[model samples]
Target chain A: MAGYPQNPSGYNYGAPPPSQQYYSAPYGVAPPPYGQHQQLPYTHVASPYGAPSPSPSYGAPSSSPFAALLPSTFPPGTDPNVIACFQMADLDGSGAIDDNELQRSLSAYNQSFSIRTVRLLMYLFTNTNTRKIGPKEFTQVFYSLQNWRGNFEKFDRDRSGRIDASELREALLSLGFSVSPFVLDLLVLKFDKTGGMNKAIEYDHFIECCLIVKGLTEKFKEKDTTYSGYATFSYEAFMLTVLPLLIA
Target chain B: MAGYPQNPSGYNYGAPPPSQQYYSAPYGVAPPPYGQHQQLPYTHVASPYGAPSPSPSYGAPSSSPFAALLPSTFPPGTDPNVIACFQMADLDGSGAIDDNELQRSLSAYNQSFSIRTVRLLMYLFTNTNTRKIGPKEFTQVFYSLQNWRGNFEKFDRDRSGRIDASELREALLSLGFSVSPFVLDLLVLKFDKTGGMNKAIEYDHFIECCLIVKGLTEKFKEKDTTYSGYATFSYEAFMLTVLPLLIA
Candidate 1:
């Protein structure tokens, strides 16, 4: 409750008008507010390397950065839409994508995630044994990306397409995380593209930061079974548990 | 503080007498109270399968369950005493021990850890990629086992060679884990070998149970960075995070 939005109505920044009957429809099948397959103006930075790029053309032929790297066909049972999204990311056509490919894919979506973020994503969703992010893992990652995008828009109340430190805190709070000021500063420092001038997080970095925090927190919870704030660990256990997430 | 021992003086159940200055000495080099290698009376069960066994002979030629399995020599810089201990556990001389070997080794120390506990140990200290527990990993584990053994002895207030539910609660509390009644009961049910009649945890089982709790808690703390007692995780992240520790 402490992290809940203070004004519920004010929180619905991007909610469709009550007249839009399909606003509440299931994801992946809902029609866009704009015309189907209509490309929006790419206002956001499309690459972490400071490049302007074309927006993604959903429900259309693949024109992603990695389009040339996609396989001709996807594995059985992969949803057609999901296969389309996966192809945009699976840059090597191995039916899997690594961190570099994922970065390019996100850039194609006009979301500029850092290499570190994509590595963390690979660490989280890829097969641990093979370090591969196949179509199934891609689907989950895409869904989370969209979910985080929605939350980001909702929290970016000014429609500036970015959230400053305070807005970021509110966003995390709404997501059930009440971080300390120290941790908040750390998050902002880690994700803020403004070089500490504005302490702001862009749409892509917000998703990256949130996923990192969530993944790390979930890993920690596995050890804190009694919900005790304190936990004991051998030196090796401590290193093994933390180093992978930070260094992966 | 809720978990702190009620009577501080009473908590030192197995402390050496005041005349014994080396009681506070560093581990691995200190002489045992009985003798440098005196075999203590084998009072506790040595095997999970109810097999009575000979006590381990320290500071002497190896006659352990896995003595025939030890390598002729150890890796360089391995502490002589530590090597002695490792040899006792490194059954099959692969220079590395798996969960089964670890279980046998703990049993040699008169500590009958369950295969599950040893598996968790491997999961925690072994090389994550190789899943192998080598000498270095074994050293850390051995140290932790000794530490836990000390704590277990301190909390076994009745000196009945086992701690009941109340004593276990005190043990965990002193170790900074104030588990809820439900968690405490669950722990007792899982670790208590008396089939839930007396709800007592033996020395070895206590060590195993405590390690499991500690490892899991440490892992959870990674994700709960905000310390909000809550975390958000994607479905795959949740499964990947929790499943290995539970099933490994």
Candidate 2:
């Protein structure tokens, strides 16, 4: 918990305070680094960012990192987006998603997500989808996980729960990250990884990847930022990085 | 073992005795029961009254009473026939089949099978498709189960692994069967629901449904036919009677 950034509102670590509301902006504009991002005009969506989110009043109220990342037109609970993902997950549409389905969804989204990873997740959520889910519907897994953990103890491999340079490396590798020399070095020194190969951070590795990516998100927020009992996060970055972790 | 019809040759139930290889006269004009009464060509399939079978093989090694009632083409492992079923069951063409699949296949073949019945059968063979089932596969789940005391003791509610009149009735009702008196009486008297619902019998019910009513493959064979120990079968009657039990 000490590594967590401070958030007065007590929402997700590194996340913005609850007061900030994103007005709908255009989507697909410059898009992200991937393929061409769609450009959505305010006319296409309902009040853009003003659209209702899936979660209730946000409880104590905290803006989403993903919603914060995309333009306002991209509302939090976009029906069409969810529908497509569900279709991918429920190939036969038998009212529930199964292991093969989750695998298909993962492959559809990121070729990197292996069948093993999807299978593990499926076992974790087997028979739970009495209600149908699309590949996108799986987002709940990641979002809930990150928002829920709030600290590194659970995922940290070395048991120290703190991300050191080498520990972060192994953890990232397990999660399907490509470690470049400079990127590894940056993450290493900053992440406090140097513990050893046998030791590694678990979920913290994933969180580290998402939150502190810099211009992308708040990289190194855990270390550089003071411990406010919560990790600091940017809306835009969390959505792209952390949120995608849950998708099949 | 009293019920286990002695499979002397061990040719799945009473498949042709691999050794003796008795020969028989081919067919002349068979009766209207197997032919004029069905969707497919009537040939080697054994008729209820021992109508002259088309195949040179006499008796056609019928497994159950209901078997006598099916079209000849639906014998064990028929190519085009099973291929159609596979298409239906393997919804995604990923090579494996699951529950809802067998359900649709049975329903399409006859009026007897229902969704609940299909689910029970699918669940019985839950893991078989993954492993290449052969000699060991033969007795492991099937014959071996006849002696199974553990599973029967487990799912058995009132210390009776076997469901009796009241238990079967309740089981059917729970599975979603209305338990019509005519069917209820018929079930109590014949289907031996009185015995414990051990995994073997469960497998038996599934195999019987697929081989008899649904016009699917007939790989499941009786141990033997003679008093020595062979399973009696009914390939003709629709399995809707069992659907209630499955739902329950």
Candidate 3:
């Protein structure tokens, strides 16, 4: 049942450098390989739960024939990187990982990170169709946010600049989260710290926000006393500062 | 790291009764071979956090040393089931299982069917100076609890009929739960459902509460539209329903 989950064995990336140093670097750059992420593009940016409709000025994508999103029994090529990502995404201990499931699986830990925005990024990056996503596909989408913005090659599901709400909703559902237009509204507001109706969510901004959220969450877990990664503040503190936000 | 964190390799356990079906009739428990809990007791009680604690009246053992608690480490060639229980207690993933740590961990997961009055059991079970309990010892304890109502092999380490505020506070810390005396009092009022004057806080009860908290938290997470695992309804329900009967 175990042996790198799925993939041909003996796929060695060669020996790593003896010294393993920490990467305390800032965002926008990739981490050193062997577990760190390099930035790339993705498509299908999730809107807020209550996002405003796009204006007519922003036209739809160009139509072209491409690899359509559908169930494919064909084996993903022998790439260890893609295999690693599959191992993480294929929850339930299953060998094959669907794209939609990736969001739910990643969201569990990602939400553990601080800041409310990772949830938004989680929705954007996950593949909703068939619930499985190969590692090669996931990396480019994750570091770059291919779904919301970026080039057509990454998300051109059928090579179109368009993805639909069902796809986005399934991505959220796989991770046990779904953004209604209401949640979408909140997402857009956070994306637009400037308060302008930015109208569309793009790639670079998505990656920036995702990294910030993750860093903050790691710091927050250290403060939680319950070992469940939550701040165990007293009722008084929680009520005065935190309760209002949840109720709202 | 994935193997027994407490017991390194070189441990032994007979293969499963290939004759036995894995899930057709229960996961099958055979004194938890391979971890520290093998010597402890087992119960079917479904509380989330830890093993169940025994009550005050449970009588002491005439056979084992040090009242009731088992030795942290058994002689080599110990049964696999015994090893399993001991390993479970190595909460921090350290290889050793100390008496203090065992009490906290068993109490943390108090599987309801585990031996009760854990603090007391811990006090009574340390038959050796190493002050630790291995799987054989833990599984034995767990089995005894499941078979009997409660056993005296357990008593608050201090030997008092009940756990006072100070004793309770100290016990909490030794287990990695850093709560204030006030918080402890609140737990007492909530969990010490039996309003006795010297409300002795048994280790089993501590575990019961943690499990309850975890269960409720999980439920709230599922119930919430946001998947944040938060909500006023969940909060009030937890404080009002679970808090009173389990804590101070």
Candidate 4:
């Protein structure tokens, strides 16, 4: 898996802007409409990784009662800012990001969260006992979801919610990476699990693949500081450093 | 293990100064005297990863010869430049770097060679079939050997060829890192295979330990960009990123 930043600044610790702030929304209630995309009312002060903020007055009966950490104006629809963080935490690429990975990913952002605290957060956000949090469900956690939505809309030219190999190539190139065809082909084969060249890449897989490639390329460029087109590496070095970028 | 640069410039690729050059003295013979440190009379152009330059006129009976890549006059004895590269390749903390690691390490210097080529270089340098190459034996390869020797000598304060934990802590501090006592203890426990707290750290281990600590601390500082001094992480993140810096 890709590594996360191990500093507090990596996480946007700024207090939520007033427009996005709301009284702590009780868990599991149909979110009160905050116009446009219905955002869950979340309190800015509550820790993102901990139990939701307490709202004694607005006690909407919730099976898994916990304070909402994200604001009601949390811009809805997938956030791109969360993609790299999500991919780093989604170690296995199973599409179901678990509490362990989430907790670890948060740590990179300098968020201190106990596993129990993460479990509670997961329960509040997911509303079911299932340990895995799918991509659609994860969107409920924050306003940065707008970042993902915007990126996906920009890339999904056909509005199909999935981008194909050619589109993926174009998307990455637009992101300023000169990904070789061989590497692109390898990536498609590795991540396009459905095995058909005609298949469009799903949102989650596309995000994961893009993030991994970008991160690895950055690492390669670090060693190739002289701007050499290629960086020579022994098989072992390749295995230890580069392989993780490719295989994971 | 730490990573190495993959550019010639990354390896300090500038041509050697006139004072360090000498005629090809032929391999396996005592390197013609170059003042205090006997410098290897390597061809100015051989790849750092392969056989000594094949100067047919000099007839250096190389087991597996290759094109000259690095400059002929490799600087002599303990130059500080090679410490990070050597530490990166010394992955296992065995205090003995092997051919595989060396070759990959050279790749970061923009040199490419097959395993057979590395084996031949090792043979010419040590004249032994042993798999492990200690620091003294490894110095025979090139003038850059000066970097490693110089670094080791600088840190081996008592002239015993080993550095104690206090010396290591000081070395890291001088390198501009604020290493905590807890992290230092953990690092010593992880790398000190000899299992004695009173034991002084040998040259290779000291370099490796320092590199690992520096690398991890840098990663932490990246997250703590605000100079907050502390960054919190969940247990899992601690395991994936920070723990590897400590335990690996």
TM-score of 4: 0.26
The docking category that best describes candidate 4 is incorrect
Tens-place lDDT per residue, model 2, A1-248, is 22222323322222221233332222221112211222221011111112233443222112555753532231344457555665556668664566567556555522334343453344233222122333333544433333324434434554654655344433333322223333444344332344345233334333434322211221222222332222322222222222122221
Tens digits of per-residue lDDT, candidate 3, A13-77, equal 12121232234221122222323332111111122111222232211121124324432222323
What DockQ was computed for model 4? 0.03
Interface root-mean-square deviation, candidate 3? 16.4
Measured against the true two-chain complex, the DockQ scores of the candidates, in the order shown, are 0.02, 0.01, 0.01, 0.03
Best to worst by lDDT, what's the order? 1, 4, 3, 2
lDDT for each residue of candidate 3 in B152-201, tens digit (9 for 90 to 100): 11325555434544454433333222233344454554445365355545
The DockQ leader among the candidates is 4
Candidate 1, residues B1-248, lDDT tens digits: the string is 23325544333222222231212212122322344222211101111111111122221233456754764333345457877877777678778777777777677645566665677667766424234576656666666666567767887777889887667766664553434444555566656667668778788677666655555554554554444334444333443454355334
Q: Lowest-lDDT window of 10 residues in candidate 2 chain A? A: A40-49
Question: Evaluated with lDDT, which candidate comes out highest?
Answer: 1
Point out the higher-scoring one by TM-score: 1 or 3: 1
Compared with the true structure, model 2 gives a TM-score of 0.21
Per-candidate iRMS values, in order, are 15.1, 29.2, 16.4, 17.0
What is each model's TM-score for chain A?
A: 0.65, 0.29, 0.24, 0.40
Better of 2 and 4 by TM-score: 4
Give stretches of model 3 more than 4 Å off. Answer: A1-248, B1-76, B79-162, B173-178, B195-200, B207-248
lDDT of each: 0.52, 0.32, 0.34, 0.43
Give the alpha carbon lDDT tens digit for every residue of B174-211 in model 4.
33333443444445543454755554666555544544
